[model samples]
Target chain A: MKISRIVSLVIVLIAASYFLVPLYATFQFSLQMLRGQWSFQAYRSVFADPNFLSTLSYSAVTSLVAILISTLIVVPTTYWVRLKMPRVKPVVEFITLLPLIIPPIVIVFGYLRLYGSDSLLPLTVSSAGTNLMLVIGYATLSLPYVFRSVDNGMQTLDIRTLTEAAESLGANRSTIIFRVILPNLRAAIVSGAFLTFSISFGEFVFASLLNRPAFGPYLVQIGQDRAYEPAALAVLSFALTWACMVLMQIFANAKPGASRRRRGAAFNPLARRKTA
Target chain B: MTVADDLLNPPSQGGSARSAPAGLPGAKAPRRANWAWLGLLPFALFAAFFLILPIVYLVTGAFQTPEGTFTFDNLIALTGPAILGSYWLSIKLSLVSALLGAAAGLLLSWALVLGGLPRWVRGAFITFSGVASNFAGIPLAFAFIATIGRLGIVTVLVRELFGFNIYGAGFNLFSFWGLALTYLYFQLPLMVLIITPALDGLKTEWREAAESLGASHAQYWRMVALPVLSPSILGCFLLLFANAFGTLATVYALTGSQFDVVPIMLFAQIRGNVLYNPNLGYALALGMILIAGLSNVLYLVLRSRAERWRA
Candidate 1:
């Protein structure tokens, strides 16, 4: 038993170091841009660059819009599938998982060809159209995560019962959706939104292929030419990813008041046995 | 009938009676079913415009000449030395990284779960895995470069501490092995996140039963645990393989076009007019979709099998 514990400790330590060393190295390197002394020079340079501001804002806005679009699409579809169209659940699930099968690079390649200037859609011709394409692409890439999150959320809630209750109370379709379903799904939507944000924010292939000035391509550009700045940016990116995951974890664990109140009611084993 | 009418009177209330004969139950059911399918229309349209149409276009374009005539020439061109070499290199890199990441991640997961670590350690590792698995692309490349690049801190430390240079020993961080090593940063964490639940699903009774049957520890693992866990392990391995196979930005950042992975090669084809062939580019993309699709399909099948065992 003691030997096994030691072995476990050793393995844990090794894994921990593997996860930490690159982060530590990146942070350390980020601090050493001012030759022979520790400094925040790399970070300062990154923040001060005008292109950084533009690109980061571009990515942030697009990712937020993408999150909104994904939620709008997934929530209704998942809800409808659960409440009314249960027979189509498998088809919905399969469509949601299609993004996982198709590589982003391939999808983007297809976008380039299909939505070119000569094509009927011509979404790649104008800069604004290209940005719209980027948002749409982001939405597509985040479909699986958003759908799964919302589906799991719906699974926990008795959607049919809730909808019936709302309908009996003379609630309209939109009222039930907006007031009842959306409120119950807040935690799931927020978690999925954050996941979408993280994915689309630092996304490379779509934004790059569409020739948008997003954060990902900017980071790659800096990575090519810069020394310490890329490390600083990497540290920043890691912190952002960490923040997104932590927030997602927190929201995902925040069970609705309805469920939490039910959990608190204590049940006696004797009562259960007598009932049985 | 309009969608609003269908929604206002659900199928159970015989909503389709207005569109069909009132007494014909069979006619009512099919009409109601068709209206219910309209609920999926918006989502289906979004997918068609954004995901399906674009990809289908490319899939079809893969077999067409640039002037829009049907041809197998582009697909045949995939066998040429440069393109085939890139495909081969990408596969090797993905295979090596997936194998190494799967093994390491399994070890870490085992040490955390069955190796009897404290509960908090598992929590921390799982949370870290969640973040690390998503931490990919350009920043990942930058982090790796900071750690193990030519003048990276680790390389510097190794030289100073051991009086030996890694690069002097032909250990180039821009090489294939270096890229695979970098890929492991995300790949290993992904494996951990995926395989942890499968590890948790292993019942304690199985081990105790084997022990009670006079089986030794190694024998119990070999006879009971491994066979049960094989599907999950193999599934996670395939997932990791697909994940690595589709990666582009990280490899592009690390090697800067010096190493030509298939994605990077396709990226260049799309970006530049030099040696540009649109059909060939489509074929390259079609090839990527095929490999990624096949592996993911296998992963899903294996996961279903593993899930049955768990259930």
Candidate 2:
């Protein structure tokens, strides 16, 4: 028993080191920008670059838009599939999973081919159109995750009961979806949105291929030329990814009613009249 | 089980949402059923425009000539030595990383789940795995480079501490093995996240039964535990393989244009730089899709078979 425990400890320690060593090395290397002293000079240099702020903000805004688009598409489809059309569940699920099989580079390649300047409904003709296409591409990439997250969330609820209850109170389909269903799905949507945000924020192939000034391309550009700054940027990017995961974990673990109560009561007719 | 299984599994076993509105007039039922598919329009449009249409475009383009005439020349060009070598290297690299990542991750998961570790250790590792699994692409490459590059800290530490020069011993961090090692940064965590559940599903009674039947530990593992775990393990390995195969930014950042991974070659083709063959890029993309798709299909099959154990 003691020997087994010791073996387990050794294995855990080795795995932990594999996960931690690179992060530790990167953080230390980022601090070595000064000639002979540990410093934040690399981070300072990175922060001072205007391109850093610009590209990050651009990616942030674009990712947010993509998240919104993904949510708007996924939540409704999942709701409808569960509540109204269970027969088409297979089709919806297949479409959602298609993104996983088709690599992003290939998807983006297809986008350039089908939506190029010469094509009908040419989305890549103008900068704005191209940005729109980029957002759409991001939405496509995130479809599987958002769909699964939302579907998992929906599974926890008795959708038929909720919808029927809402309908009995004279609520229309849109009102029930916007109020009751959306409120209940808040946690799921937020987690999915965070995942989407993280993915799109540092997405390289789509943003780079579309010639967008996104954070991923900027990171790669810096990685090509700079040394310490790239390390600092890596640390920063990891922190961003860590932040997203932590936020996702928090929201995912939150009790369904913890945050949903207020929104549900505000929009729910039965609760509104009873509270009044 | 995978999300595919979760989705195909009926959402509610007893409370069929479609039956809820049965109190309505008989005429309304058929009309409602017909109109139900309209709710799927927005999602269907998005999928068609963004996902399906683009892929269909590429599949068709792969068979066309430069002037839009039909030709098999592009697909035939994929057989050239350079392109074939790129595909070969990619397959070998992905296979190596996936196999190593799966073995290491399975060991770690087993150590955590069945090796009698404290509960908090498992929790912390799972949380870390969640972060690390998603922490891929360009930043990941930089992290590896910072750790093991020519002037990296590990290299320097090993040199100063033990007088052992790694790069001097031809331990190039920009080569195939280096990239495979780096791929593990994400792949290992992904395997942990996926395989942990399967590990958890291994009931204690199975081991107890094996012991009561006069089986040794190795016999128990080989005769009982491994057979049940094999499907899930193989499925997860395939998932890891597909994940590593499609990776682009990490390899591109680490090796630059020098390394001829198919994705890099495709990137150059799309960029119209050194390789200006768009139709050939289509074929390459098609090959990638087929490989990823084939693995995923096998994973789904394996997952469904693994479900019997879960039940």
Candidate 3:
């Protein structure tokens, strides 16, 4: 037993160093921009660069759009599949998992070929159209994560019984769907949204291929041209990824019915007064 | 039973009229099954345009010539030493890294899940795995470069403290070993995330039963535990292989397009350095799809088999 404990400690220490050292090195290197002293010069330059801000915001906005689009598409489809079409669940699942099997570069390459300028639908013609394509591509990439979380959420809540109960209370289909179902799925959707954000935020293949000035391609460009700034950017990127994971962990641990419970508590006093 | 009955017997036109006022709680209302298909249309259409069509384009374009005629010339061109070498090197790197990552990750997961560790250690490892697995691409490459590259902290520290130069020993950060080391940053964590559950699924009763049957520790592992874990282990190895195989940005950022992995090659080809043959690029993409697709298919099959054993 003692031997096993020692082994576990050794493994943990090795894995920790393996994972943490690179991060520490990157952070240290980022602070080394000034000669003979540790400084934030690299970070200052990175913040001052207009491309950094534009690309960061560009990627951020697109990631949000992608998350919204995926949620709009996946939530209804997942709800319907569970409630009405359980047989097609496997088919929907297989399609969702396709993005994982298919590399982003290959998918983007296909997009470039199929929707290039002079094609029947020239999505790559205008920058706005290209941006739309980027969002669609990101949505496709994150389909697996979004679908899985929402499906798990739906499974946890007995959707058919809930729908029946809502119907028995004179709730219409849209009301039950919009008010009753979506609220229960808030935790799942938020977790999926953060996963989508992390994916699309640092996504390089599509943005680079589609010639968008997103954060990913910008990082690659800076990595090539500058040294300390790239390290600073790497640290920043890690922090972004860390932040997303933390939010995802929090949402994953949140109770699905907590909001409903909170509402019930708030109205309990009113009910008590009426009864009295 | 109602679903099965609905499939077997369609309600007659008069039956619906007769049953309208006979509405009982036990009887299911005849659902419009066609509406279910309609509900799936948007997802299907999106996937068709973005996912399926692009692959079909690559597969079909691989067989087409510049003049739009079908030919195997592009595939034959893949047999050339240069392209073949890249494929060989990629497969080797992927296989090596996957094996190394899988073995190490399996051990780490075993230590955390089964070892007498504190609860928070496992939680921390799992959470860190989630972040680290996604923390790939350009930033990851830069992080490794800052750690182990020529002017890197570790390299400098080792040389200063131990008077041993890593680079002098012929370790180039842009080489195959360097990329494999960098690939482990994601690969190991991915393996841990995947294999931890598989480890958890191993029942304690099985080990006790084996021991009661006079089986030794090694014998129990060999006869019982390994058989159960093999499917998950193999599946995860294949997944790691595919993940490393399909990598592009990390390899591109760490070692410029100079080092030729298939993805990097395809990236360069798509960027108009296509050697005047677009079909060859298609063939390359098709090759990547085949490797990544086949491995994932195997992983899925093994995963299903593993689930069955657990059941």
Candidate 4:
């Protein structure tokens, strides 16, 4: 028994070292100059760099825009597919999952050929064009999450009953969709958006290929040049990514159980009704 | 379980909201037609310009010239002994890492499932795996460098106490082995994430029945467990293979793409100013897409088979 316990403990320690120790080392490395002197000079260089702030903001803005585009695209499509085109559901799913199926290298190469200045659509090889490709790639890359979550949400709903209820109350079709169904679909959409942003923020291949100075590029550049800041960036990115995942889980958890709990909370009529 | 449960029964059947009432014969008709028709556009346009067009062009690039021609020369060039070495080397590295990952995950899952404290360990295992699996690419490469790179603490420690300089002792982080070791970070977590669910897919009755029939541990695992989990295991392997195979930017940042991996080979064409072989680059891209796509199709088939077997 003791032997087994000791073996298990050893495994756990090894596993922890395997995962966490490297990250700690990177942090220490990023905090110093390459000459073995501990200094914040690397971070100072990183922050003082001209290209960084733009990359940061551009990435943020592009991620937001891409998530918005995907939301506008995914939500309605998921709804319509669930309602009417159930037979073509597999095709829709394949379209959504094509990004994962297509390797990033191929996609990046195609973008250069298809979207470069010499190509049909003349999006200049600047931040905007790069952002456009990034948006397109990020949107499609995120489709699986967005579609699955929204589709999953739609599946739980009785669309006919909900529409009937709202319609009888004189809600227009547009109002019923925008107001009633969409509000209820919030959890799924929020989760999808957060996941997309998390992914886009850390996206490497697309940013590198496009030569877009984004957060991912910044991290890479720092890693190549300085040490400590890259570690700081990694930890920061990890925290940011973790926060997004936690947010997604929280939102995902806010489904049937959350509604029930809210209803249960609302059972106290004297609490906030007229008190509303 | 919550997600799986929610997936089995989701919000599309909620207590409220429905379409316009069936008044005239065409009332439901146009609503269904319009909404459904409109939904197809976004999916179609996006898939066309981005997915299909790009892929078709990429494939064509391998064969056609900037002027115009058809040839297999590009493909021929890629399969030469020199390129083949790197290709095989990449395959070897990804295979080793995948195997290592699988072994680690299998042992960890076994421990969590059979241990006295299942939930606590399982929860921690899964949560950490989820975070770590997604925590790869450039940042991870940097982390490894910081921890184990030249002048890193580990390197310094080894140099002082063990009379071995990791960098000087031929432990080059820019080498093939270095890249593979770095890849192990993502591979292990990925295996844990993918295989845990697969392990759960193993119904407890198989083990019990095998035990009741007087089978030894190895016998039961070989006869019952292996067959049951084969598809997911295969799918997991393909995923790891494609992941390591398609990796760029991360390894490039570390080694400057000189190690001649397929991803690096293609990327060299993309970024090369000297050779300027766009056709070769495109063909290489097509080869990459085909490799990844075929693997995904295999993954889908295997995953479906597993689902059917489970059912």
Candidate 5:
């Protein structure tokens, strides 16, 4: 047992090293000032350029806008399906989840065919609407994660009670939805929003196909046109992605504990044995 | 997984909720948006417009001639030599990458779940995996450039220090093996995420009990843990296969369309001027979608099997 464990430990370390090499090397390359010297020139070069910063910021704005739109679509739909028309839950779920199941290229191909040239609709290439469509694609990319999380959250809460309580007080429909249900499902919303933001921020497919002024295309341009600088930018992208992913894991993990808390309070002793 | 499982139980759910409200019952649902599905309509609309309709056009158009006659020429062209070679290559690449990813992920998950690590270290590994996994298409290609490209840092350093060029050593990144290696960056981490839960599901008691019963470490793992984790390991492998099969962005960025893997070839046929047969491209896409659909069907079957086991 001891010998096997030692072997496993050694193997794990080697795999870890293999997995982390590109990350470490990218950092190493980025930190070099002279040919072999350690310096912050890469960081300076990245920040010194207005184009890079503007493009990254532009990508961030798209992500946020996409998140807002997703929230607008997902939250109410999820809430309504759970509370009233529970039958359509599967259809809603299917539509939202289809993007993940389909190959991204197929979807992107579909996008280009539908809007790319003078074929289908009145499509202005690279217009704001084009950018908006990119966000819509991103939101679709993230729908599964958000929908699952929020739908899970809705299951744990006493929605009927909360709604009745609010309605009895003469709160309007919009106020009840925006103020009450949204607040309860906040964590899932944050998780979904953050997921959309991270994915959209790193998105390459729609952004590239659409030729939008986004971080993905910007990185691609930097890599092909200017290799070393793109390495430095890749490090920056890695850091941003690393941070957001941790936040996502934290959200996914907390879900179980949160549901347990709600159920614990609601379940009587009889229900405990029944559940167990 | 909680919601994912619940959604899978279609029999327990309602039917034809097209315009019905599915939220809290306090608010009466006779309003315009509140009639049934106010918020979800836009997303469904979004899916239909961008995701559904385009694919409908792209795939359906494959069956028609350029002048509008429905025909199987596009589908027939799928079995041609050029396409058959590329399809075989794409499937081969997908299988190799997914299996390689599964092996790497099994090790990584062992380190993550059972191998002891400090909270911060575990946190870092998990975070790094998520970022690295999601960091698939664009930035990964960029990182590989700095680290592995012909004039990349490692290649350059190899020349100056040891007078050995890895590219000259026949480790090319612009070829088949190169594309596979690039894919490992995303595939391995994703497999780790998917397989970790299954590894975690393995009971430590079983290992300890097996050991105390005079079983060797190999016996404990081979007879006990491997069997226990086999379903997830299998499911995750297929998921990775599906993922790699459909991938467009990473390989495209790495080798351009010079590689001519199925997705790239399909993209070239439809989108690239060089391949002017859009109908043929649609037929290729149909094949791709059929494979994707098969994988999902496998997921459903396996997922239900998972439920049965638990039950």
Candidate 6:
């Protein structure tokens, strides 16, 4: 036991260095832009660049659109599958997991070939159309994460009982979905949205192939041209990922059961109002 | 169970007898199953257009000549030295990185979960793993470059502090081993995130029972724990393998299209930098899909085996 404890300590320390050294090195290197002393010149220069602002915002907006579309597609499908077509649950899950098995490069390659300017559909003929395609590509990439999170959330809810109760109260299907089911799935959707955002924000292969002015390609461009600013961008990207993860953890820890309990408690006042 | 089941799947007469007015007419009951599929139509269409068709196009394209005639020339051409060497190097890099990541991640997870660490340490590691697993691609390459490249902080620090020249010892960050090290950044955390739950599934009572039956620690592991954990461990290794195999941006940034990975070769081909052989590009994509698909299929098989043990 004593030997095991000692081994554990050594393992933890080694793991810590492995994870932290790169981050520390990057942060330290990013400050070397001014030369001879630590300074924020690298960060300031990165933020001041016109390409940085444009590409960052472009990726951010693209990520938001992707998240919205993913939510709209995933929520209804997962809910319907859980409520009615339980037999097709595995099929739906398998389809969503395809993106994981297929690489992004391959997927983008297919997209370019199938939808290039000379293709029949020709979605990549114009900039706006290509941007739309990029959004769809991101939605496809994030399908597994969004669908699984929402499906897990739905697993915690008694959808049948909730549907029956809402039906008895004269609520229509749309009302039950929009007001009842979606409200309950708020935490799951938010967590899935954040995950999608992080993925799309740093995505390079799709954006580069599709010819978009996105943050990922911009970072790669800077990596080739400038040194310290790339390190600065790396630090900023890491922070963005860390922030997304922290938010996801918060939502994940706020499990459905706790919220449901609070909602149940809130119903007592309504019952008292009816009694009075 | 029966009562809940009855509520969920009421008797044919029970539904009409109890709530005929409150629900849709009883006449519409038979049609509900037919129309229920309409709810999934949009998702089905989206998948068919964006997911299924592209793959179908590639698979068919792989066998066609430029004139639309059927031929396996593209696939046969894959035997050329450059393409074959790229695939070989990619497989080697992926295999080494996956093994290295899996072993280290297994040890780290074991240390956190079973090594009698503080409770908060487990939480911290799991949270950090979630972030690090997603922290890949371009910025990851930049981080590695800033840490271990020719003029990197760690390189300078090692030289100045310990009088050891890392590059002088022939460790170039642009080489195969360096790329594997960079891949490990994401691969290790991914392994931890995946295998932690599997390790948690290892019940303490099983270990106690093994001990009480007069088995040594090594015997307990080899005879029982290992047999159970092998499925999860092996499955995670394949997942890590496929992950490293498909990676593009990190390697592209680190090596600048100089390295000969399958993905980089395919990237150049797609950009029309190589001779514009669209059919050959399809074959290349097909080869990549086949490798990734085969690994995932094996992973699913092993995962099912792991699930059986849990049951």
Best by DockQ: 1
lDDT at position B98, candidate 1: 95
What TM-score is obtained for chain B in each of the predicted models?
0.93, 0.89, 0.90, 0.84, 0.79, 0.90
- The CAPRI-style docking tier of model 4 reads acceptable
Q: What is the DockQ of each candidate?
A: 0.38, 0.38, 0.35, 0.29, 0.34, 0.36
Candidate with the larger lDDT of 4 and 6: 6
| All candidates in order of TM-score, best leading | 1, 6, 2, 3, 4, 5
lDDT (Cα, tens digit) per residue for candidate 3, span B98-151:
998999999999999988999999988987988888888888999999999999
Task: Please list the C-alpha lDDT of all candidates, in the order they appear.
Answer: 0.82, 0.82, 0.82, 0.69, 0.70, 0.82
What TM-score would candidate 5 get against the native? Answer: 0.84
Best-matching candidate per TM-score: 1
Q: Which stretches of candidate 6 lie over 4 Å from their true place?
A: A258-276, B1-30, B273-275
Q: B1-311, model 6: which lDDT tens digit per residue? A: 23333334333224455545646566645554566687798899989989889998888999999788999899999999988998999899999999999999999999998898889988778778777888888898999999999999999999999999999999999999999898888888888877877788899899999999999999998998888899999998998888888888889989978998999999899886484788998999999999988887788778777877666
> What's the C-alpha lDDT at position A196 in model 1?
64
Q: Model 2 over residues A1-276: C-alpha lDDT tens digits?
A: 787788889999999999999999999999999989999999999999999999999999988888888888888889988876788898898788787766778899999989998899899989999999988888788777777667767877888889878867877667778899989989878876776676678889999989999998999999988989999999998999889878876666662643332222111110000000
The predicted structure with the larger TM-score, 2 or 4, is 2
- Writing each residue's lDDT as its tens digit, candidate 1 over A1-276 gives 888889989999988998899999989989999989999999999999999989999999998888889888988888888867788798887787888777888888778878898999898999989988889988888788788777767777888889888877877677878899989989877877776676668888888879899998899899878999999999998899889878877777775644432211010000000000
For each predicted model, how many residue pairs clash, with residues at least 3 apart or on different chains? 0, 0, 0, 25, 15, 0
- Give the CA lDDT, 0 to 100, for residue A193 in model 2: 73
Q: Considering DockQ, which of the candidate structures 1 and 6 is the better prediction for this target?
A: 1
- Writing each residue's lDDT as its tens digit, candidate 4 over A1-276 gives 565555666666677788777877766766666576777766676678777677878788878887878877877667667665788889988887777677766776787788888887965467667768878876766776677677766766777678768867766656767898889888877866766666677677777778877777777666667546776676666787678767766776676533322211111110110000
lDDT of 4: 0.69
Clashes of 5: 15
